[model samples]
Target: MSTIPLLASQLVVTTIFNSIESLGFSNIAGKVFSGEQAEARQEANLKVNTKKFYARGLKSLEQQDLYGAIKNFTATINLNPQFAPAYNDRGLARYKLGYKQSAIEDLTTAIELNPYRAKYYSNRGFMLTRLKDYTAAIADYNSALLLKPNLAQAYFNRGSIRLQMENSLAALADFEAAIRLDRDLAKAYFNRGVTRYKLREVQGAFEDFQKAAGLFKQQGRMDYYQDALAKLRQLCY
Candidate 1:
């Protein structure tokens, strides 16, 4: 049976903490020397300001203000060029605002700044997937999984890409791994159902669709719930 692939493209966010301590200026408000001491005080003030700007950027991101988030993150990066989280978040904001290539560049910069962050690779993989760069996207997902073995979203996304490539068995394995790692991953169940149906496992598909529909309803995702229900109906009749 020829199978049609359904892919999901949702960008996931990562929460990161800044390592720089916020040094309050109260201690040096009145007493400050020249030369190296003056330069030290200036550096301390910049770190504090960088923290504040980074916090504001995170707040704006939470409030769904993409432009505000970008502006604040840019300030944070200007204050501290090596701050990887700022670049990562700015990339997220750019991606949301439809600046896909710029988003990818920001993500790449973030990765260069901090290669240990698994989420950075996953995020860039998502942008690559949107651009239909399946091979590169898979490589990014592979890197993410290698860095963090329990990253369920990476598995789900890789499975989605594999499905698109007509590798249904590999897709099924990835979806299963994702579902095992995160039971609440409703989309994983839904996609696994699609994979199962393509593999002629009608009963498995029916069960998966039912589970996906229930989970989607619980998550308040009406569109996905309706789609799952529709798939179930097709299997039933």
Candidate 2:
């Protein structure tokens, strides 16, 4: 019914052409159109296109049109009421539009619909973190970790929450895990550096600050980098 089916068919053929060719078929395209079975498969796939709406939403998100993405994602959810990603993306769109409470409800529903999705929990945790519900944010981050243990961002967010609570040891552990998973997280380095400074671990603090400063500079966030540098000077100069 839409161009999306064409895209999906192309994707499927691209991934499985070799196997199809080996089965006495000249090519996937030729074999795919040779019989009633193939025609029926295509018809079924074309009709089952809640995913196409979801894909359109993702494309809109990539274009930074949050409202457009929300519209498409909402359509996808209407097409298939149980689509978790559509709900998740719609929640994100609502958040960007400053509908904070609605975003929270949508994200919460997404988490309920698919508790195993780490991104849903992670996004909800971020919103909760901003809302100053550090306790709840920690719980959400913990849920994400349970689903995807190696998720570096979840550790970093959890670390931030622990840092806010002044639980420096726990925060440091999380930041360390985050750094292990992704070395490029400047915020992790900066926050960890601050925590180390509070703990009187001067060398550790200095190292973290230096790394964080470089990362900040790379990101063009020079003001914070300057602050970190000033702190470093106060620590060692």
Candidate 3:
């Protein structure tokens, strides 16, 4: 429910839509088959309907209509229960609606349906962190990293959790990894600055805060930019 996790959820939804669009489902009937033409046709129709409902769900999410998104995502799943993306997206909608346990369950089902997708694990990890299940959250983040080593968000989330646990050194490592993967990730720099400050690395912290402020300004995140500047001022003066 906090700003960072909410942003993560939004990013995940955007990634899900991008993945769906990139797949380019063209009529579903375009794939020719030799046998069971009638069955194939039915399946194709179902796929098309599933995609339509999924699109509606995504639109609802973009509109910040959590209930509508959940409804349409449920329709998408009803049409195709094996659709991993639908479950993942519905989990996010559920989280936005404060259905924490239900969101975790949906995300778990998504992972079960498609274990290779790193974002599902990352999404579940964020929810678990909200639930204060730090151990499970760390495991999920670890799994996400295993599936996609360059996932900056997973590293950032894990770093945040580690920082909460007062493991500043480990958190710093994760934040550094996140920044390595995504130099423009202002949050990562800000958090790493925090971790470095905690560890008495004052100069490093100052540099990171300065970089974070610059990136946040470039990204139009005025609130974060101001926050980073405040931290820099605190460090300097």
Candidate 4:
């Protein structure tokens, strides 16, 4: 279950990971995108007006000015209704502002506009999980995994939802998939350990917890290491 929360965080960043989209456009940008693409550009468009909307929005988010960031993203969305990235970016800002429902709407529109993009589904799934819509969230994650079969993050997310349902064995399978894809996934290790413990596989739990702590320490995530250590000492050790 704890693993589910961590997976949700990782999946939520899918939208932000490709955050640079629609950030650096200019009138000259049209030169590169000809025909319908060039003629489709909107006047007073945020993409052409300036990169400031995206940059400023990201900056405001980093500064904890969540409302300000949302405003900037709003400007972006108003300027480019068809801009999937703009919608996704706004969704992220909205999510941070605790506008979960609004974020879901924005992200949903984003996915509809850009159905081929895996990140959109991942982002939507992240929010759905928060909304406690586990079924929809897993469906979205599955959509992403369908496009990118080896996507460790998607596996991690699905594993989390399974964990929430107390399906530890299924959760463990997904965690193992994630680890096999990326051995450095500390979250997967910790989560798999928790799942193993719940399944009464004590020795396996101990090994996983120990490895998770070591991996967290290697990544300079001391809080994670400390937490894992406490759990290991109290339960696994």
Q: Which candidate has the highest lDDT of all?
A: 3
- Residues 1-237, model 4: lDDT tens digits: 354455777767865655545454334446666655645765435467546676777788888888888888777667667878777878888898789998999999998898988889999999999889999999999999888888898899899999999998899999999999999999999999989989999889889999999999999999999989997997833
| Model 2 residue 12 lDDT score | 84
Off by over 4 Å in 3: 1-35
Instruction: Give candidates' CA RMSD values in order.
Output: 22.3, 15.1, 21.4, 21.9
Residue range with the least summed lDDT across 10 consecutive positions in model 4: 20-29
Summed backbone clashes in each candidate are: 0, 0, 0, 0
lDDT for model 3: 0.94
Question: What are the runs in model 4 whose C-alpha is more than 4 Å off?
Answer: 1-47, 50-52, 235-237
Candidate 4 local Cα displacement, residue 106, angstroms: 0.6
Question: Model 3, residue 189: displacement in angstroms?
Answer: 1.3
- Model 2, 1-237: lDDT tens per residue? 555445877888876876666786666555656776878977677546887888889999889899999999888887777778888899898898888888889898898888889999999999988899999999999999999999999999999899989999999999999999999889899999989998989999999999999999999999989988987898877
Which of the numbered candidates is closest to the native, going by highest TM-score? 1
For TM-score, candidate 2 versus 3, the one ahead is: 3
Distance (Å) between predicted and true CA of 17, model 2? 48
Quote the positional error of residue 56 for candidate 1 in Å.
1.2
Give the CA lDDT, 0 to 100, for residue 170 in model 4.
Answer: 90
**Candidate 1, residue 66: lDDT:** 97
Quote model 3's TM-score.
Answer: 0.81
Q: What TM-score goes with each of the models?
A: 0.83, 0.77, 0.81, 0.76
What shift in Å separates residue 233 of candidate 3 from its native position after superposition? 2.6
CA lDDT, candidate 3, residue 33:
46
